[model samples]
Target: MPRNRQILLDNRPHGEASTTNFRLIAEDTPPLRDGQVLVRHHFLSLDPYMRGRMNEGKSYAQPQPLGQVMIGGTVGEVVESRHPKYQPGDKVQGMGGWQEYSVVDAGQPGALRKVDTTHVPISHYLGAVGMPGVTAWYGLVKIIDPKPGQTVVVSAASGAVGSAVGVLAKARGARAVGVAGGPAKCRYVTDELGFDACVDYKQHRDATSLAGALKEACPGGVDGYFENVGGLVLDAVMLRANAFARIAMCGMIAGYEGHPIPMQHPQLILTNRMRVEGFIVSEHLEVWPDALKELGELVGSGKLRPRETIARGLESAPEAFLGMLRGRNFGKQLVQLV
Candidate 1:
């Protein structure tokens, strides 16, 4: 058995998460039991949702237990298997956590899924063609549902989920606008990801100023919105939203650090008669087949090209995750464990 390296949640965060909140350890891999498979992880996904799990509180999901491996998605190869269904060298994806290896019970439904890297890369099973892509699809297709010529806006538009949202909207014949932090990110959102226009949120100090920039980008009032970073970004979008506009509340990264995010004019929802829906993608498992099919086709056809920012080594996961939370990553933040 190979030696396994893992990072565990050492403590819950008080205000903001830091590397000290995690502890790394090495352990000998246990022999696989009947119907068990051993996976040697090649890539680990670092997402913003993990930050929310670091705090002990009530959330859509259970809090990440202290002293346990930090929960995350992983893509890897099956090295050893006692299960009849799994064979050695098979590419698989699962909730392998922050570890270099995983022991999965193959009998458990959805515990391990074989992936075909013929068209889509295996690492992408954790990003564009996996959870994030499905997240974007559900928010935009189910909630926002933009029409042709309508303007759709998404915050954190250079990120994994937001980038896909903009492209998917454009495929539906809607004009996609983006709001990102820096000029480089904004440029990539427009030029690379094919967003119609992008607004640099850093240039604006207040929501009013940001809203002004949004007005310029979205000449036609925003008909649909995908909210990732709440706070001022959400405020700005709300100000420019058209009557009967739809808003998909995906994530509020701005308030993830135990901060209060008060809406300046929440009454705008009532005034505009907008439909605002908050959703958890996991809860909508019924849509996964349809969503993954469309997303897979888009990626395989070179229509939806998503980028990635990778950190090498398992030890790099903490800082890389922190950098992603601060918006330092260009695309999907991943840790290369191999």
Candidate 2:
């Protein structure tokens, strides 16, 4: 039997998740039964949702079971398969967890799907053409449905979902404006991603400053917003939004860690008649097919450029994940495991 290495959630963190909360387990993998595929993970995705999974609370998704394999999406290659459908060397994607290998049960519906890495990179199955891409698509197309000449504001604009939101909005002929942390990220959000403007939030910590920057960027008033950061930025956006503005509340990174974040102007949600909706991407599987096709075409045509901060080796998953929590990485954060 070949030994399999896995990362388990050792303990729930006190405030922020630390490497201390994760344990690496090395054990021999048992033989696969019928309808089983031995998948060797090549890349593991570290997303903000994982932070919520680390907490013990009421959430859209179940809290990650304690002292178990840490849950995550993985892009892998099927090295061995007992299932009639799967074959060796078939590139696959699944909820393969944070491990070097996973024995996926093919009997379970949607357990895995074959990936085409010839034109599209396999790592993208975890990013641009994957969950984050579809997340942006759903929020943009279904929720905030912006029109040409309208202004769409995006928070955490340098990140995976936010970047995608800005680009797709621009592609749809909407004027896209971004709110990012630093000058460099803001530059990338505008210069590289082709957003109309990017407000560097770190430069303006106070409401007055943030509002002023947003005003300068969106002179006509914000018509739509794709929220990802969700603290003071949400407050600013709400205050600046036009009448009947629509906002898609994605991830609230500010409150992800057990911390108190005050929203200065939540009252605008009612006064402006804004349509604010929160969504969990996993719940809406119906739109993935169309969304993925559009995302793939966008990425394939070199129109959508999704950046990633790649960390080598499975051992780096913990540190890389922690770094992402602190806003240390730009775009999507992924760990490559061979």
Candidate 3:
């Protein structure tokens, strides 16, 4: 029997993630059953949502169980099969996770896809045409529902999800304003993505100044808010929403760590008749194919561009994931397995 390496959650962090929280160990491969197929991982996606799973608390899904493989989405190739549905060399995508191989059941729903790489980069299944891409499309179309000529504000503007929202909003003829952490991301959002304006959130220490900065950026007031960070940035945006504004509550990266005591701004919602709704990608899966077609065309035509910060090898997964938590990586963070 051959053995494969798997990464497990050794411990949970208080505020941020570290290499010590993860344990990489070798495990034996059990025999494939009647309906299982052996998968060789090609790419493993590291997303902000993984941070929430590391904690032992409530979220959209149950927190990852202790001593178990850290759950994630991956694009893989079929190496062996015990099921009729799959054959060797078939490329597939699923929740195979951070490991060299996995025994996936072919009968399992959404096991993977037998795809050709000629259309686009195979790794894109974990990125632009994959989960992150679909996540961005769903948040903007199904949630924000932007109107032409309206102002749409996106936090973490240069990231995978943020970039998707900005491009889609602009395509709809809405004015897009990006809110990012530094000057580099600000430039990428405005210059590359063609956003109407951008705000650097790192410069402002508190909500008061942040709100003032946003006011300067969107003088007409914000008609749609695609929120990523949830601490002071969210508090600041609350102050500037236009009447009947719609807020697409995506991931709350700011609140993923220790619970920070943020100022309450529910009154803004009440006074403006704002509709702020929270959503997860799974809830909108039915509309994903349509979103993918739209985004795929944009990518094909060179109108929608995606940025990625790649790390080589499976061993570097822990480091790459930690760097993302600390705001160390730019664009969509990914691990390329060799």
Candidate 4:
């Protein structure tokens, strides 16, 4: 019997997710059907969105069921195939979940798409040149519509989606300002990521302090806001926003712990005449082709540097995920399964 190592959701976390919510197990790999392909996952994408799925209620997607493989994006090689489209040694991307191996149906739409690693690395298909990259494109291009010489502020600016948001804003001739958790992340955002400025949120925890920091960083007032970390960060930006400003409300990691994060300034939305919209990247699949093309070119040319904080193995995923929720990981979090 072929054994497959897997991680299943053991507990539906009531407040916040921890290692206790997950368990690792070994299972026998079933023989592939005629239309099936066996994928040996090389890299597993660990995203903040997975946190919401661990909860009980449905917000945007279905809640992750207990005693099953944790859901996520995976980039791997096709090891065995009884399918017509895919054969052995082909690199593909799929929803392979958290496992050493996965058997997927080749007939499924969006099941497996072969990727080109000649110009770009395969792992990037899980991050920059993939979901996070296109997500940044959709939020920036379709929602924010940042123009040259405008000031754009990105929350959680050193993480996967947020980091790409800042880079995309800058590429479009906007002054990018990032908000991160600590001084180191602040420095990385400014010095390395080439943002105009960065505010260390840890230094200014309260709403008053955060507002002051935003005031100094965005002197001309913010024209565009790419929000990934909600809570006080969202509240702070609203204080000094330019009239008719646009905000792409992405993720709210701060309130993901089942806490209510009331916006301190609802009147600001009215007074500023702001456009606030929230989106899920998967819903806007039409733009992936163009988004991926542009993002891939930037990444290939080293213009858009995609950073990763890779954890060693599958067992490290639970700890890595927990740490990521706490803002410990700097960039795209990945568990290198192979």
Worst 10 residues of 2 by lDDT: 200-209
In model 4, which residue pairs have backbone atoms overlapping below 3 Å?
Answer: none
- Model 3's alpha-carbon lDDT is 0.85
lDDT of 2 by residue, 67-169 (tens): 8999999999888999999999999999999999999998797789888887789988899889999999999999999999999999988888888898899
Winning candidate number (lDDT): 1
- Output the better candidate (2/3) by lDDT: 2
For model 3, the superposed segments whose C-alpha errors exceed 4 Å read none
Write the residue-wise lDDT of candidate 3 on 1-338 in tens digits.
35889999989987777889889999888899899988988888999888988988777888988788888888888888998878888888888888888888789677665655666676777777788888878888877888899999999888888888899999999999999989999999999888999999999998889989999999999999998888888888988889999998888887776666465688898899999899888777698779878877777676777788999888899999988877787888888875
Question: What is the Cα-based lDDT of residue 51 in candidate 2?
Answer: 96
Q: Model 3 has how many clashing residue pairs? A: 1
Using all chains and alpha carbons, the TM-scores for the candidates as numbered come to: 0.99, 0.98, 0.94, 0.97
State residue 316's C-alpha deviation in candidate 1, in Å.
Answer: 0.5
| Models sorted by TM-score, best on top | 1, 2, 4, 3
Could you give the C-alpha RMSD of every candidate to the true structure, in order shown?
0.8, 1.0, 1.8, 1.2
In candidate 1 the C-alpha lDDT for residue 37 amounts to: 97
Residue-wise C-alpha lDDT for candidate 4, range 1-338, written one tens digit per residue: 25889999999887878899999999888999999999999999999899999988869999999999999999999999999999899999999999989999989888888999999999999988888888988999999998899999999888878778888888999999999988888888888778999988888768889989999999999999998888888888999799999999889988888898899989989898999999998999899999999888888887777778999889999999999988889789999988
Which residue pairs in candidate 3 have backbone atoms (N, alpha carbon, C) closer than 3 angstroms, thus clashing? Answer: 93-112
Give the best candidate by TM-score: 1
